[model samples]
Structure formats: C-alpha cells, structure tokens
Target: MKLKFDSFLLALLIAIGLAYFFPQAVLFQDGKFIEAVTTVGVSLIFFFYGLKLSITDIKYGLKNWKLHVVVQLTTFMLFPLLVLPFKSFVANAVQENFWLSFFFLAALPSTVSSSVVMVSIAKGNVPAAIFNASVSGLIGVIVTPLWMSLFLDFHTENVFGDVYWGLIREIIIPVILGLLLQRYLGGWASKYSIRLAQFDKTVILLIVYSSFADSFSSGVFRTISTSYLVYVFIGVSVLFALIYGILYVLTKYVLKFSVVDQITAIFCGSKKSLTHGSVFGKFLFLNNPSAGLYFLPLMIYHAFQIFLVTIIARRYHRRKEEESQ
Candidate 1:
C-alpha cells in the first residue's frame, strides 16, 4: 500500500516555508491587528465546539468513571510527568525554549476530531471518546496554564490575573455563550462541522505562519542545528511510543477494559491538540521571540501521531471486521 500524506500537514509545511521566505506578510504587526484576528478565530472555534457538544453525551460518558479517570490522568498528569524528568537534559542540550516547547506539548489536551475519528475507526467507545476529547480541551484551558505557571513566572506583577483573564475572554466565555445558544444553533453547527473544522485549520495555519515568521526574522531558529531538530523528532516519537505502550497495557490488562474502551483510552490519552496548542500559545507566549520554537514540537508531534495512529487504527478496524465476518 502507498503511504498517504495528510493535507493539513502539507499546509503546515507550506505555512512554515512562507513564513521563512516572506516574514513581512505573515508576521504580527505593532497594532495587534493580526493578534485580534487570531483571538476572534479562537473564540469562534470554541463557540462552534460548544455548539456541537451534547449534554446527554457528556452524562453518558461520565457513567464510565474508571475509564474517564484513566484517560484524564494520562492526558494531564502522566504526560507532563513523563517530560519533567528531561527538563535539565533538554535545557543543557538545546536551550530552555526546547524544554518549554516539549512541556507545552505535554500539557495540551487531546485532539477532539482526530481522537474521536480514530476511536470510531477502531470500533472503540465513541461516546466516551467524544466526551473525553471535548472535556480535555476545556480542562486544558485551566490546567495547562497552571502547569506552565509552575515553572515560568507568567505574571510577575498580577500573578494569576492575566492568565485567567485570557482564558476567560478567549476560551471560557465563548464556549459558555455557545452552550447557551446550543438549543438554537446546535443543529446548524452539527450540519456544518466540516466547514468549521476547515476554518479551525485555517486559523491554525495563520497562527503558524505568523509565529514562524517572527521566529525566522528574530533569528530564534538559528541557535539550533539541524541535528538538534532530528533529536527533537526522535524525542517526540519516543514520547508517543512510551505513552501509547503504557496506556495499551494498563487499559488492556490492569484496568481490564473492553477492547472498545481500550482503543478509546489509548488513542485519546496519547494524542495532543494542535488547535489548542496554536491558540493558547498565542496568548501564553505573546511578545516572546521563542514563540515559533514553542510550536515546533507540537507540529512535529501532531504530524507523527496522526501518521502512526492512522496505521494502528486501520489495523484494529480491519481485525474487527474480520472477526465479525
């Protein structure tokens, strides 16, 4: 079988190339116009997200308390802990920025669309996948920043003020508004989920372009060598492999979950969201020159996870089909 390349991955590469070649066009300007655009895009993305979420779905998912606990712990707690040990190693080897980027990737929530899709393909617990994927992003809005603040002094003056404000304005409020209007707009949102997904990817590409443009212009990438980037790729791959293997064993053996729930746990727990990474990075790393480098691990991990998981998901799907037949 021929290997297929994802269009979004291709688009991400093109965005980076454009940012490198034409930094002026994509770089954020002094007036904050581009920043405002990204903020609006983020709000709309969350709004649409809320519109699609069903309260009943969440309630159904919560019935599996053990499964939810495992998934959440794997996403927020275990993932970060796995990276914490490498802090001094990464800092000494590359720079503080590389460690920060890796930590940021670890702190992010799971991918909503892809995780659910993979679970469904693998004949996993679809409702639980949807619920976990959706709730993980919301949880990350609060949890991710808290994790970052533990290491980086986000607000030297106001402490929690700025971070909370950003989350409220950009993520929480919009999601709440969407939920309030879900009765009226939920159907419409569901009908146009594909379009909204495209919109989300477009906004992410814009953010990527602006970030890399700034990094390129500021010579941030210059500090790192090509060899270092290869190491980062290896590191991300190893991280994914380790997490995936552990989750597989825990869900399959220790937890004694069904095959379906095992698939959901492994996929949802192992993946991270590029969507949240892009938008949250904009707010968290504002005015910081290392912003582009901050997204590097996420981008690489996003591509790698999708590619590797697709093959695994397809194999599971095929096995299920054979068994049923």
Candidate 2:
C-alpha cells in the first residue's frame, strides 16, 4: 500500500510537471472553460467525500461529544488565533492580500478522509476521527466566515461577502446531502471507496494544477520570491509539528484516552483540510491575484503531514506487533 501511494504521488507530480512545462496543454487554457472544469472538479471532490462518509458512523461519532468540540475549536479557532500574531511580523515582508490568504487558510475546515486514514494507519480510533473530521466541515459554515470577518476589513477589495455563499453552496450542501443519503447507498459507497478516493485525489491534483497555473499564467509568480515562500514553508512545517506535538502531550496527560483514541485525537486535532483551503480560496479571494500564495503554506503543509504521518503510523504498526508478541 505504501509503495502504491508513492507511485500515485509520483504520477501526480508528473501530471503537475506537464502542466507546468507546457502551460498551454493544461485542459482549457481559456479561462472560461478552465473555470468550468475547476468547478466540476471541486463538486466531484465534495460529492465523493459525502459518499465515503457513513450515516451510521455519524450517530456513533456524536456519542464522543467532547472530543469533537475540542478538535473543531482548535482547527477553526485556536489555530487561526495563533497565526494572527505572526501577521504583524510578516506585514512588511509580505503583501496584504498574501497575508490575508494565509490567514484565511488557517481558518478553513479540518480534513475528513485523510484524518481518519492516518488514524487507521496508526491503529487509532477510526470512528472518532470520522466524527471529529465530519463535524469540523459542518461547523465550518459558521466558523469560517466569522473568522474571516475578524480580519476582513476591506470589503471592496477582497469581496469575501459576495463569494461566501457560493462556496457554501458548492462544497457544504453536497457533503450534507451525501451524509443524508448514506443509509441508502452507504454500503455501495464503501465497496467503491478505493476507486472514489482515487478519483477525489485526481480532482484535488487538478485543483492544485489549475490554481498554480492560473497564478503562473497571470504572472503572479514574478511578484513573489522563492526565498520568501521558503520562510513561510518553514513556518508551516513548524506549525504542523507544534500542533501535532501539543496534541500528543495533551492526549498523554490530559485526554487520558487509550492508545488508539490518543492517536486519533492527535492526528484529527492537528489537521487542516487542503480541499477546503482550495475551495474556500476560490470563493474567499476570487478577485485577489495571490490566491495560490495563501494556499502555498497549506499545500506544503499537507504534503508534509501526509508523508510524515506515514512514518509515525508505521511506528504504531510496530507497537501493535510488540503488544501482540
């Protein structure tokens, strides 16, 4: 499975490389058609996310109410608050829109499938991960916008108010409908989960490509430097480690959960969803040219978390082996 994931990632890299090198070859170089394709890809991602989620699991997930609340609070509230201070330092170094973009990234929803997948790989509590992750998205509708209103002072330039409803319609509604339909098709959804997840990943890669491609084609890259972004990337890495590390310590002394539940709480608690980051950026920063800049931290962070957690998950696999011994 690890080998196959490496292969999939390699293929995705190759696909992105092609988009980078031959920008014209990117499906629909014309902005109108490309936008349509982007919309479709976004919808597909949410639709599959809905299908992959189970209705029965949701009921069971609600039983662990405390875990869900903390995870959401951290993802939507505390994480954003933590980044607010850094804005003053980066203010002179980075552009306002760029700073706004990253600030918005921090407030977006937590991931669902990958969080649960990481917990499962680490032999953690799958059910709790599912519930906490799902709950974040549902709560994000209110939380995300409120988070934006705090920092979003310039309505004319950012146009966040106009774009907010579009995003809620595109991403949120589909996910809720998917959850509601779970009773009828949840089993079928499970059977095809592997295929659907791959499809979803493809959609995400497409989003990444289109996002960067749009910025590249518009000459947005010229305004930014690789060195500056490197610093932001480092910030993202440190932030990722900090969140997971804090979760680990809290789970140990505070949560007092079993090993599996601890791992679930840590991974689920530490994550911010890239899919939501992308979808929201499209809505939240529509007129803003540096949309990709905001997501830059998160993209790097997402890639980092996925590979790093795999290593951590393997340790748990070995621990399970020793316990069985």
Choose the strongest candidate by TM-score.
Answer: 1
lDDT of each: 0.89, 0.73
Segments of candidate 1 deviating more than 4 angstroms: 1-4, 26-31, 90-93
lDDT (Cα) of model 1: 0.89
* Model 1 vs. true fold: TM: 0.96
- Residues forming the 10-long window of minimal summed lDDT in candidate 1: 86-95
Q: Model 2 TM-score?
A: 0.87
The lDDT of model 2 is: 0.73
Predicted candidate 1 versus true structure: per-residue lDDT over 42-102, tens digit per residue: 8899899889888897888988988889999999999999999877664362467888889
